[model samples]
Target: MSTEMISITSYCLKYDIEGSFIDSLEDGGLIEIVWVNNERFIPYSVLPQLERYIRWHYELDINPEGIETIQYLLYKIDLLKQEAADLRSRLKVYEGTK
Candidate 1:
């Protein structure tokens, strides 16, 4: 529940012995990011951005500032869902009483 969200696109990355970032496919997948929100497959084209995220965040463990937003977001979503369910139950009770 305390997972983080990150954004790292502008930073540079090095790939292969040549030292240039591999901005194309055909080599290793140029993207890797796993998050609570990204539970499913995001668009394939966005992989490079995900790759940058993995390199800078996961492998390096260097999460950006304010990355705790995900945790807060998830927490609020969960709370709202529960609250909605409770309201529905109360609504049913009031309807029956009426």
Candidate 2:
């Protein structure tokens, strides 16, 4: 088992322990809407859900393929940014409604 991080997709992500997927989560990554069959499709609702098994991916040092590694990290940052945006939007919505 190793603690590592990799971005599975733009929206849905996977965290694994010992080569087994342990957790999956939703954070509004752009890939969420890319799979739509049509423009009329709702982007937010169609987003894939992170599977139940994924868990925290600890920072690690094992090197992956250079280009793949860069893509993975960039998407991870995107996930985090989307999460922050979602949280902030939710907070503002609740505050305004109160």
**Alpha-carbon shift of residue 88 in model 2 (angstroms):** 0.8
Clashes of 1: 1
Which 10-residue window in model 1 sums to the lowest lDDT?
17-26
Residue-level error in angstroms, candidate 1, position 26? 36
* Per-residue C-alpha lDDT of model 2 across residues 1-98, encoded as one tens digit per residue: 43223333432323233322211112223223232343212143332322211212334332223323454688799999999999999999999998
TM-score of each: 0.36, 0.32
Scored by Cα lDDT, where does model 1 land? 0.46
Off by over 4 Å in 2: 1-64
Clashes of each: 1, 7
Q: How many backbone clashes does candidate 2 have?
A: 7
Best by TM-score: 1
Q: Once superposed on the true structure, which residue ranges of model 1 sit more than 4 Å away at CA? A: 1-62
lDDT of each: 0.46, 0.38
